[model samples]
Target chain A: MFSAMIKKELLLVFRDKHALMALFVLPAVFILIMSVAMRDQFSSKNLEFSLFVKDLDKTSMSQEIIKLITNDKHLVQIKEKGDAQFFIVIPENYEQNSNEILKLNVQKSLKENEIEVFKSLLSEHILKARFHYISQSIELYSGKASKILANLEISSDKLYKVKYKNSKKLPNATQQSVPAWIVFGMFFIIIPMSTIYINERKQNTLMRLNSMNVSVFAMTFTKSIPYFLINQVQVWIMIGVGVFLVPLFDTPALAINGSVLAILEIATGLSLAAIGISTLIAVSASSSEQATTIGGILNLLLGAVGGVMVPKFIMPESMQTIAEYSPMAWGLDGFLDIFLSGANTQDVFIDFIKLFVFGLVCLGISMIILQIRIKKGL
Target chain B: MIKISNVTKTYGAKKALDNLSLEIKEGSIFGLLGVNGAGKTTLLSILNALVEMDSGEVEIFGHSLSKEKTKIKSLSSIIPQHLAFYENLSVGENLDFFAKIQKASQEDYDKAVSVNALKELMKQKASTLSGGQKRRLNIAIGLLNNPKVIYFDEPTVGIDPKSRNEILDSIKNYKNFGITVVYTSHYMNEIEKICDEVAIISEGKLVEQNTLENLFLSKDNKSVNIEVVYSNILKELNLKLLDETNIEVPKEQLCELLATLEEKNIMIKKIDYGSTNLEKYFLKRTGVEDV
Candidate 1:
């Protein structure tokens, strides 16, 4: 019996051309446009730093240092030495005289914090080279030098090391935009769901169903199942667009590194949350016009507050705190964990629970409201 | 069989159903007649268990509606005034859905479709059907459950004559099948034609309730109106002055009065006879002619 109800709902939804467009076509198009537009903001390939080098030592050691700096893919060597954000000069006799402390001159067009980072890297490389020179000279000078150097226990690992846990790179534009917009589009299901519910009430189908011994919960669940399936399909279509279609327009391809199970879990959670919210909107609205209006506005509000329209990291701190309360935020985070953060099922478990709980709460509230309306004959 | 007593429903300060009560017998076509906001729909809603009634006990088929709502609901079906089927779905799909909800078997579904003559439009979307076809489909859905009792709230409000007659005929056939039908309509002729028993409600009160034959018999006097070009000639006869040039006389006295008017050289332009109708009974009982 329940399956039949769900089948009826699916037929109604699939036959509605407007609903089909809202479910599949609009989200795909929005994902493609937004992901492509924001590609440069998150792609690492565009990162480059210009460095100007003035080597006066004329020694192989100073040349080797320059070679090391230029070898970095992110740093580009400039032929117009003076016209660079960073200028480095190696003093004469810096590498020839072992007792002479090296004096490296540096100049920059900007005094930003990033220049400090560059300076630190240069200093670390220079210090490593000096230590190596000292060790080699000592080895050549005396047999005891090897024993002394071994006792010193000089190791680069000990000198410079940093550790990170689950420190994958942040999500690129395409990766973040795809899931965020997918969630945004999925919640828009409220419009169609609410409209359908309103239509049923107007047509007396609900009253007829009530007369047939169908419970309010049964009707709501049956109506939501089809849309939930539609939402899941919507997630896959957006992901496909991000992975395959967006790259055709010269945008970075979204990489899906997480396990399929983790992605499916997140999608399920998101679908439930969207369906729950749509059910609430469906039962609460007095008419289809009101439902559609309220659903559209609410979808936009949730998208804005939940970091779908703007990245939460860039939002104001207070807004970010509030975004944590949004189901969309939880859903977007779960997707990001799998798509960009390389998280497994266990990694997104909290987000999954949150989304599912939110969905259940919404569904519960909708049922309660429906029950009250039924009892009151509203 | 359905029984409702002292059922009152209020919305804010307005009383939709005030101390309303009625009993419907099995295998009978009962007509509920009322004006708009006369609590006809509210009464139907309560009987169908769609709404709660305050200070009342309703029993359907010997089951308390409040205590055994599920049982009562299972036995009843509502064909509301509006088109309730999903427009996007085919007629077959709509019927199948209702049948599934009612837990009807395949055979029952086939019977319902065949009975309603909707087999030819099974594949057509409900939105594409003509008004008459849509009404048939609505009735077909109501019958999907093979319900013991059916409440049709203005089922034939807006339809062509052919469709209207077809629906009216189908409703009458329900009696032969021993299915209790509670029908409500604004059309007086429909009630007079289909209902074995009729009840008229006004201002949330039952003005009259009885068998159709008894109600018709209760009104003993039928009158005829005579319109004449000349005025005030009927003063000598036992007649009621309707206007300066028209007078209404009892049907039994009509021949004598017409002969008197002819003898008095009063040229009659038009003569009208009052027909025995539920409208007249309703107007007489409720003292409101608008309905």
Candidate 2:
């Protein structure tokens, strides 16, 4: 009976292309896309995109500014304005005319933050050129600029070193995105889980099973085992995408410095948590549409609050505190501990316990609701 | 044999089943007939253990329903009004899964499959099956373990006439195999066609329990049902409103009732004369006149 039930559940999920996409493909895509897109932010690198410079200023100062900004590793100073996401126009005689300001034209689609960072970098470089001329007490664009530049150390990037407690490896985009999305994807088991469960109830299959003497607990157990395994598979596949595919786009591949077993434990805990809540949702809802709606809203809210869409460090302090309360946060933190901090099973054991207990409580409540509904013949 | 003694169930202020007792003999197809909300489902649920009677003693095949629920459950299966098989699975897979749950032998479901004529659709996904085929699969599932008793909860509510007959024929066939069938439906025609004995419930109380033959034979042979349409002219006379916009009176009073209605400019709608089947008996017992 157990084997047949397990097989049936497995077939039910696998045969549903939509469920497979929700559980597997969507997360894999998110992991790849998010990791690549977040590369610059996590790596402390300048934004990478096309830039166009229209240097109308015929002065040496404008030439110097153009040289410095173009020298950035990620920015390419192109001549075509159409190709450039950011077009900078150095006003004519900017060094001679004190009233003139540099003008920058940007595409509407450019991310606001990246543009801000680029603007700051441009200002910083311009100021450094002005300070050099003032320190030398010479007129702007004097040939003496090269003489001073030869002796001065203009780069300050190395002065501030990013450290992660005692860890040597730098945390990168893949590290954050891989774990966060895996946790997010694992919870989507609710979608398919709620579907099958709601169908079972609406069809009176539950009553039929009861007549066959199959306990609800037995049914829930059989359902959980398959979904838990699916979650594990989902985690590994997304990790494979991060480890093997994300790097092809120049983003750093995911590095799992923690024990693989520990990661699996965290994933397992998350799977249980997801199943528990999904069961509750399924039991509470009257139809598949209702289950999907409730489950969808809940997953999105949880993901948003749990640092799945945005890293906790980026959130305000109060928001971070709230993130700590989301079960998804518990799972994400557990994975991050291993992925970024290289912690082992022992380090994430508490997180696992938190998730496990939450799952059990949900399952307990769900079972209670299910019992009430069954007795009430809902 | 099955016996329900003084079963009472309540939902808030509504009593769904009030001290209802019944006896269904072994190997007899007993039909529980009633109108909507007549506690037939409540009784079926009680028998299937899907519901708990507020107070009652139900014994099936000499097994106490409460004390030996698992034993009783193993002895019977229900064909619910709703389809219950897994639509994602093939018919064979669903059968195999339920068969496993019931600990049924290969020959058990093989016989069921053959009886239900599902051999060709074995590999077809259940969702793709037609309505009649779906109903057949439902019965085949209940027949998996060859339970001593089977409960049908309005299984043929909506379907083509051919499919309904096919379902009825299969349900009646289970009796030849010595399985006690307890069928419930509001459709009196179906009960008349297949049921040997019937228990009519109204407002959670049993109005009648006897063989279908005895149930009609024992009714007033001289009296029949007189139905009418209402008009303001006949509003002066007090009449029993068993159903909305309908009334029933004994056949002996048909002329007087018609005369008054005709004199009052009211028209006679239907007069069920010289017939005493489960429909009229059920209508008479439940205080409902066929519209």
Candidate 3:
């Protein structure tokens, strides 16, 4: 009998061409578009930063400062011998008139005032070079604003150095947002699945089926099958594409096996959630337009909360905690564990379990709602 | 045999069915007749176990529709007005799916309803079939389980005359053994032709139930209307006919009598007979005509 229901469901899935498009074909297309759109986001890129330094004093202190800045990560120093856009020179004497005048010049080329700060830092550094060019500024000098101002009028011999280590790593913003899109694509496909099934119920097809021997749960679950299959395929393709495309920026290919498993588990769980959501929409909506509107609003809400549109890392602490309840968040978290962290099955097992429970609860609620609707002739 | 005892269903302030009770004997073709809002479908839904009545128990072959719903399901089949099969599948596939639902085994399925019988046309999708063909397939699906009790709800609603007869013939031949048939329709002729007994419901209440011959006969069997050109002579003739024994003039004739007289040398333009079909019985009982 179960097999019979499944067979009938498959037959029905195939019968409606529009449903097929909404489920499988749309999900696949969505994953493709999203992966392409976000291709440069998560992938690592060969970074290059434009550096500008201004120095008035030609002291060894200024030269050493320039060397430290040049040695910084992926930075190229572009300083002029004269009044370059950024330049610094150390004075010969420091006792009389110890104050240094800082000038930030642009060849009508500089876009922002960071060059102004760059010139100020170099002038201060030349003042410090008049004394001992100390590397550890933290131990020798106080970083207090008042003390720095007082030191500006004192002899260069009292000048203490403030310097940073050359080695530093910076993450690309585009890379951080890329993975979110993959999950968003999954969410994008899922919303329609929810809406279409709701539409079916609004049209009284669900009641018509109930008038036959089909069970409420059977109808609800069968409606999810096409979506479930499509979502799984979508998860697979998006993960695969994400993996392949990430390497374009020299990032490691997203770990495949773990990511795939986690995605599959979350997809199953989310599919149940989708079923529940659709059932609620079907029952609660008095009109098809109302159902679509409510379903659309819900999709957007879930998508945003689930971190499909925002990176979970950057979300506020409370929002991050709240995201745990979102089906998309669970899926995205599972995906992150596998692709972002290279986790194994055991690593993602908890996320899978959480998602599974969420799916089951939602599905159960949906079935109950559907039963009421059926009995009530909705 | 099927027995419905004190079944009642209510929707808020409105009573969809009020203590509706009836018994349908085995091997008998029962016609359930009613107006649009007569609660006929609600009663059927209860018997089919598609819904639980507010208060009542329905027994089919000594099994309660609620407690022994599975058994009832296996024993009964329903042919709804709308087609419910997968239109994407071939005829054979559709049948196969329904057959599997009933747990019909390989040999029994072959003998009962051959899957291969639809083989020549197996490649064609069900959506491509005409309306009549689609209806036939729907009926075929119902027959797949070889149920003893079949419920046909407006089975002939939108079909052409030829296909209508074909379905009727199928229903006629459906009772080779002692299989019960519950046929519901608004068409009086269908009830008159195929039913052994008919039940009429009005406004959520059962107005009458018995063999069609008995109900029509006991109710005077003289429910007919005749229309004629409005003239003093024809109106007088109609008045004289109304005065005949074994006849009753409903309220409409009294209201039309005065206006019907002023004209002269009136010819009978047309004659219409609104004989007491089930709809009349419903109107008489419910006191509301639109429903």
Error at B28, model 1, angstroms: 2.4
lDDT of 2: 0.85
Worst 10 residues of 2 chain B by lDDT: B272-281
For model 1, give the RMSD to the true fold.
Answer: 4.4
lDDT of all predictions: 0.83, 0.85, 0.62
Using TM-score as the measure, which candidate wins?
1
lDDT of model 1 at residue B241?
82
State each model's C-alpha RMSD to the native. Answer: 4.4, 8.9, 8.7
What fraction of the reference interface contacts is present in each model, in order?
0.86, 0.84, 0.37
Candidate 3 lDDT, tens digit per residue, B82-113?
67676667877877777775666666455334
- Candidate 1: lDDT of B274? 30
TM-score of chain B of each: 0.84, 0.81, 0.77
Q: So what's the TM-score on candidate 3?
A: 0.74
User: Which of the numbered candidates is closest to the native, going by highest DockQ?
Assistant: 1
Model 1: per-residue Cα lDDT over A85-113, one tens digit each: 67667777889876655443446455566
Q: In candidate 2, what are the lDDT values of residues B78-131, reduced to their tens digit?
A: 888889999989999999999988889989989999999999999999999999
Error (Å) of candidate 2 at residue A3 is 1.0
Candidate 3: which stretches are off by over 4 Å? A14-73, A77-179, A188-226, A245-291, B88-90, B105-123, B222-291
Q: Quick one: RMSD of model 3?
A: 8.7
